[model samples]
Target chain A: MPNEAVQYLLTSQRDDGGWGPYPTLPSRTESTALAALALRLAADVEVGARASATSGARWLTETQLDSGAWALGDGVPGPNWSTTLATLALTHFEGEDGAAAAGGAWVLGARGQGPNLWSRALGLFLRPSDTVELDPDLKGWPWVQGTASWVEPTSYALLSLKRLRLVGPAADTRAHIDEAERMLLDRQCDDGGWNYGNSRVFGDVLTSYPDTTSLALLALADRRGEPAVTAALEALPGLAADNDSTLAMGLVAVALATLGGDPEPIRARLRNQLSTWDGGDIRGLAWAAIGLLDGSDPLGLLDG
Target chain B: MVSRRRFLQAGAGAVAATSMACRGRPDPWTPEAAKKPANSPVAILGAPDYDETRLVEVVRQGLGICGISARNLRVVLKPNLVEFDPQGVINTHPTLVAAAIEAFRLEGAREVVVAEGSGHRRDSQYLLTASGLQEQLDDMGAHYVDLNHDRVRRTVLKSSFTDLGELYLPETVLDADLFVSMPKLKTHHWAGATLSMKNLFGIVPGAVYGWPKNPLHWAGIDGSIIDINAALSGRRFNIIDGIVGMEGNGPIQGVAKQVGVLVFGEDPVAVDATGARLMSIDPWKLRYLEATDAFLGNVGEDRIEARGESLSSFRANFDVVTAFEETKVEPSTGGAGGPARIDK
Candidate 1:
């Protein structure tokens, strides 16, 4: 019954695994995507964990509203947050795509532009079953845990494709990365953090915030060996009051350590600060719990 | 036994420095909860006796000098700005909000900003903008922050609800010396009626966990509400707006009937006790009553010192919005046209 937290999160699944109400739960998208991501983390922890994760993905697959579109509650099933997040959760499951055809049916049936979170996410996941084809600009989309309004949604769609290494032409990837990196580089807080500015879904309420900084840290850690990442790593210590905020910062700590960036002391410091969020809170708790468990001792997930 | 032993061992630092995050305590209503008998007095706050003007006065006077003053305090009025629209009684009304601002101002208040991290979809910003909150604040010369868009400071402070203090509140509210929550007396699906004590949860910054607004049902009401109530230590003040109380199912989708009464007090529990009594409900019986119910706040009918009019004076029968009844009421939408209004 106390799994009520997980239940509430799962109840949020769309016909796709992705989520949004935009900025938070009930607005919908972030919860679904993060839950999907959380499910992925739990699944990766144990083999059947992925099966537990798939229930949500299946919900997305089953709930693929008739008209071949998806939404949070009931609206025109446009290819926005819900459609895209659902696509990500369903396709990225740990198992083979036994339900791929059914999922693909819903994806192909989708209306609206073919470049939204749904369309872009689909292009990355379900393809010709050959090469990972992607639109050039899609590579540099902001990979935020939550949507970042126009820049973030587009940026996330673009980056999700890049993470899959599915970019079509390398030139487009460069352009996308350059654009996203420029946007990211300029917006870095003095403490090497980032937050929602005018481009935030929650209004202008997120300055001096750690959540966005964590996303940016994830992005930088993905490029851990880079100079920009070095600067971001340098800024993390100044921002730390404790460990929950350290997921993004911790990832960078490991990335920096791996890069031989004077990280031993910093890694230990952030590691001590971080706690196991394996319990419940937000979608990031799903990912961070896995990361923390893996960090303590490699259970062999994505971080390893 | 091993898990409990392990839990005790691992919980060393939990008691030390924790934040204002919801602890994952087993909800009392969970199937697992029946194992332990839920024994506790349900706190009740009956409606006050005073008229509208006096209701405000009595609450301020009741506040007295609880070791705080208006001139020195950076007073922040956090009304239930959950979502922008006032039409739905789920949020604090602009009238009550303005009155609190005015009252705080009378107490020689320095600043009063009515803020919230409303969970409404933001693509509907044009719609939210029409909530008339901005205009009200603009006219009143007060700051209106979409906590969704406000600056926040994250810390892991100590809390009774959870061991790790969970995630502390954002500095926007945490920084203020005093936080006065003016919540509407409405029926809550999870918490029954979201009175004074329950409304303070809005002050928790959503950014630390990544969501802009707290997902009410995420932990149902226990983790969210209990942790919120437990985090506040200072003598908090709550003024319940029951002139038109929401009944049945509420906080959002309830019908507002004229229950013309204002309830207020220093202790959120005491004030809410008055509110529940006014609604003809026993505070102990309400669903989301756990967090504050345990506080020494519950005042039984015999013991409760009532100053204003009693619940007997007004027996107005009002049908509140008990559940989600879909109306044609689309918020001020963008490309989406507004749902046809019934009044027109």
Candidate 2:
């Protein structure tokens, strides 16, 4: 994928103080959520670099709805997906109670009542033995073949909640997590994985890839069931390192690190993979850093 | 014993799994790491003679006292192969390696492999070939494997004492029934001293880690030699070629001295400590020794019983190149970076 495209899909702001669609067009939930995240990342980078960190924050604050929810524009704001990202984004502005708590509450609510998004985004928030509450975080979901519900937004929400040690309605939470895990597992093509939207409700059909498998593994690791764990292990080997997306490689490292007992082999693979990266991939680095520091299995436990 | 057969059947793989069970150390796969314990002690020997013909004999006696049989054992002898002036006394001498090889064969060693990993930027094989040990290896029907590129690898290294992550070791050396460390006596800039244990830095792989074969060097923990040796659980031996010593900026570029004393031991640390004492330096101040002492739970003279030559009996000129002062003017070799900025 184009670096610009991934950046656009991930950024939290647009030039006009509005959020953009995942990659291109400006939309309500994604654009707002993305803009919020961009603001936080920008602020962090600037703090370390001693550059301006508030431009992104300013954009986020300007875009927040009166209900303390963030939106792409002035629309009825209740979509929890946008709010979850917004909450996470605002998590950076901890000093501003009005904005920070608004964002945190949205995250907590969505985590408690929203869909499961624990795999791809907001993963840094998760820890072992965590359950979070999430409120519905999006509205007017977009899809190509069918109507959308909690799959996409819920995945992001679950990750957000998992990070903060909050997840709930144990039965429903398990069910949503289970369905996503199964669709991903059951959709494994000949080579042992779903391509695009197989695991993701809005999975990447155009990118039938191991990166998607990588995401599924992260989710499965957190969702945790004997079958899910087993299926994940089976699917892990199917991931090709030379694929279009290295995202899978990193996630595979995480899952293997978690499931495998002797980490020497896996650690070797991780070092080999990490050293090869161009070092500009912040998202990839985030996961790589976690793998290096701590993973589903605390990395310190293994000595080769 | 739960079926001696089954316990033995669960090979290094089981031990690898156990190594996986500990944490709190650096990932050894990377060049930098935390100091760790070798789990088992290697024999350390002090010598009454630094004579060329008697060097290997003293080493053998040290191993014998420590209960490691040099006879009929597949052995890999590793030495420092850093690129430096031969006359500089900064490098391991060819004759020292030759002595060990001949003695091992005489003792009925099944086969011998003389291996070394030189400067990460230089080929280790070239150093050995240049030092003329390759010829010695061939003469004895022994083989030479450059630790830098050889593909022998196995993982089961778990330091029971530190958080250093699971690490991999060269398969040839790891598989050998007897591993012998043969390092020239020298003082270091980082580890503060180069002894039998410090010489083990050559065991690191440049193929996997690239240049700067040691990760602890990068992590600001230069005493990696101590941790790496401490973590070694395999049956190994230590032999110091102190007949001629290199002091100041050692293990690479240093000044040559006629310390004229050979030290040997079952414990890499103990032998190294004795080497330092013979040089009239305190072993406690050494980076590797300090790190080893912390990991081993104590640092005292009582734990060590010296044999062969007393520390006072051996003396050498330690006025050699300092490790940090040791710099090379790369020869005018041309490559991808164009003409080498060669200094004479």
DockQ of each: 0.02, 0.01
**lDDT: which candidate is best?**
2
iRMSD for every model: 19.7, 24.5
Task: Count the clashes in each prediction.
Answer: 46, 82
Please give, for residues B1-344, the per-residue lDDT of candidate 1 as tens digits. 12222222223222321221235443222232121112212222233432435544544553442323577567877777654345546566665666667667777777776666554322212223445555567667886554543444444433333333444454566667677777887766445567776776666544333243323223224345545665554535666777667765455556666676666555565566556656655554442342343333443443345654545564443333322122112112111221122212
lDDT of each: 0.45, 0.47
Candidate 1 DockQ, CA atoms: 0.02
TM-score of chain A of 1: 0.53
Off by over 4 Å in 1: A1-304, B1-69, B84-88, B121-128, B154-164, B210-216, B287-291, B315-344
Worst 10 residues of 2 chain B by lDDT: B332-341
